[model samples]
Target: MKKLLSIKNIIISIAALLLVWEILFLCSSYSKALFPSPLMAFYALIEMIRSGTLLSNIGTSMYRFAAGYFSAVAAAVILGLILGRLPKVFQYINPVVQLLRPISPTAWMPFVVLLFGIGDIPAIVIIFIAAFFPVLLSTVSAVGNIDPIYLKVAKNFEISGSAATWKVIFPAVFPQIANGIHLALGTAWIFLVAGEMVGAQSGLGYQIIDARNNIRADILLATIFVIGVIGILLDSLLKSAEKRILKLWGLK
Candidate 1:
């Protein structure tokens, strides 16, 4: 009942916000060309949905996002595990990692474009960069921060090598790693759109640019709304997955 009420409140809040937006739009002096009303944006969204352009753009974005995000997660987790197990290796790479970590994924656009040219490749590469560091750092921290007693207990139980690492270390640190993944997911989505804006000819970001070029504020606003909705859905999906995993691991 509490959960249902919470969801009801959320719906009510959203409706209230939309009402406020409509009121503001009615009062504002900005032309419809410059600032579209929510109703106009909703009409544009319906048009896009009917035309199939919205689905196509979303599909393209998802393809690029999945490819980049999964690869980054795999690579980062493996490297993080290795580095976490070997402090010397981490120390040796720490300087280079730190130097590169601070660089924004958007800042890499010029180099990425020059290297990969104008297409999905550059966008995927940018997403990978956006997703990698957070997971890597978080995994490393989680592993390194594990209580010493757990390590001793594993050793005492004759749990050694890969078995120990997977059964003990991974389970213990999963929450922290999940937190990192959640953070990276949001970051990757942001960079994916920004990357697509500069590199790809399709996807939500490209549509925004196309809408602006064509002087369609309604379409632009609708695309932005879709992006926000997709972002929320993505986070919600991750949260659900995290909860399931935690339950399986007896951490929930």
Candidate 2:
């Protein structure tokens, strides 16, 4: 009953917001093309849905996102584990990482476009770049900051090499690494959209561009709203995955 009430309240709040928006739209002197009402945006969303353009763009964007994000996670975690285990290697690489870390992934758009041309390649590369450092740094920190007593325990048990790294260290640092993944996913999504907007011919980002070019403010606004909804869904999915992992590790 309480949960139902909570959901009801949320719906009411959203409805109120839309009502206010409609009222403002009616009162405002601005052109509907420039500032579309919620109803107009909804109709636009329906049109896109009916035509299958929205689903196609969403699928394309998700494909690029999943490919790049998973690749980044794999590469970053592997490299982070190696570096975390060997301080000397990390020390040598730290300077270069620090230098590159501050640069925005979007700033690489021109270079990637020039090198890879306008397509999925540049978008995926941008997502990878955006996601890589966060996961790497988080993993490295998590692994490096593990307690000395854990290592002592592993040594006493004679769990050496790959066994020690996998069984002992990986489990200990996984929670922190999961947190990094969450953060990286959000950053990757943002970069993916921006990359798609600039380079890709077909995506949610391209839809936004197409809307703007065609002077369809309703479509643009609807796409932006859909982006937010998709982002929330992606975050929820990652959190669910993290929870499952933590549960398996008995850390939850």
Q: Which candidate is the best by lDDT?
A: 2
For each candidate, give its TM-score against the true structure.
Answer: 0.94, 0.94
Candidate 2 residue lDDT tens string, 109-183: 999999999999999999999999999999998889998888999999999888988889988898889989999
Q: Per-model C-alpha lDDT, please?
A: 0.92, 0.94
Candidate 1 per-residue lDDT over residues 1-252, each given as its tens digit = 999999999999989988998898999999988888889999999999999999999999999999999999988987887788888789989889899999999999989999989889988999999999999999998889988988999999999988988888888888889999999999999999999999989998899999999999999999998998999999999999999999997888
Which residue pairs in model 2 clash with each other?
Answer: none
